[model samples]
Target: MHPQIFGVLLLALAPAQVFCIFNRRTWGARTASSPLARFDGPASLVVIHTTNTNPCSIPSMCKSVVRDLQIKNIASNSSDIAYNFLIGCCSGVYEGTGWDYKAPISHNYKDPAIHVALIGKFDESAVPTHMSQSLRALISESQLRNKLKNSFTITEHKSNSSTRKLMVKNFLQGFAEYKEQVNDLLLPEQRAATSTTAKPAVSVPSSKPSSPTTFSTASDRKATFATSTSKPTTAKNQFFYT
Candidate 1:
């Protein structure tokens, strides 16, 4: 390689190396159940899904759910990755972001729209036993964490599973209501305030505060569904568990 190009490459690597050194000062892992998933708000809705639909391929039933339930804020970059939090039907917490209460473009996301995935097609079918119950628990806790003193809304792609999990307000931790949200994507306690927090600490360029997650492919989505419909046959089953 050319010496000049290699020198520039060395400079590029320096920041990433430094970031690895300092990341322990940032996000802490606080379990998948933190209310810091969305920022403070009188959240309008929590989006719920019943499948991992790769709409571009074999028409997925969840495609309609994504279309109807996903919020089309101009700032979210793409229509994909639209949910504030996605809980797979297998009770796994997959992708999530945002809890912003301020400017949609500049601030972090804090949407109360807790989206859950059925891990398979649910528009015309049934969700797995574990998924159906796990999402109820999460959403129920979310109601209390967000301090929804009054009635709040929980949304799903379909009108089935009429969630009684809202009863979670009666089952919340003693102090979840008192805790304030930090930035909105994660708990303040979970943020890299000190060591010992177990966040998935990935290194990236300094230009971005958070790194981008890779998108699921059509084949991957199909495989996710296939695994859900039958016994585990793919690697995604690991992700679907709590």
Candidate 2:
């Protein structure tokens, strides 16, 4: 083929090329005991979360933490890791359930949404610049791959329980920085809304605790969902137990 033709072909294929994300296989994720549920359509929302645990900056450590998370979820009777993706402090993105499956927390959202968790406790520490950049890149890649809608809205994960306070402070700070950084990618209406505290336009049910268990350690906290109450927004939406 002519050089110009070859150059054009490369340009055309660039959008589909892999980004910095580490897929489940590459991260050594355990196979789900049962097949995960598929999304009905492209995700329209992006939910951000924190691991409430130590951060990992290297690929080996990040992969171990990711695998540990998967194990914990399975032991809790979860189908797999709850988030669709997880970002390490410096290890780039690690795929959780990936783009096709519905996250275990999906029931909390009115529309399909992908969950991304930052692999570290953020209550006191600022989100690392590298982690933030990796997250933004992952979101961009998601749009390019059609895993996320171009107008997808981003929201932070909130815990209804008071015991879960460790994530609130810095998580909010990190979220603000992230929202601003991705302003160009958000829906126009969302971008126009200047208030970081503004409520989500769409309403979803709030997860109700069933046989709730509380842990003194932030890392060990867990809660099971049983029922939900109709809520009028996703912003500051409380879904996690702690």
Residue 46 of model 1, lDDT score: 44
| TM-score, structure 1 vs. true | 0.33
| Per-residue lDDT over 1-242 for candidate 1, one digit per residue giving the tens place of the 0 to 100 score | 10011100000111121000001001121222212223465454444444344322222333333343333322244323344444343333332342332222212223443443444444333444444333433333344345222243443332223341221212211212211212334345434432322333223211111211112222223332211211111111111111
Model 2: CA > 4 A from native? 1-19, 160-242
lDDT of 2 by residue, 1-242 (tens): 10011100000112222124556766667877677788656676787877877889776788899999989988998888888888887535677887778778665555688898889876556666545545555655555556777565666665433343334434434432223223333456555533335443433332221121111111101211111211111122112221
Kindly provide the TM-score of model 2 when superposed on the true structure, using C-alpha atoms.
Answer: 0.61
Winning candidate number (TM-score):
2
lDDT of each: 0.29, 0.55
lDDT of 1 at 104: 22
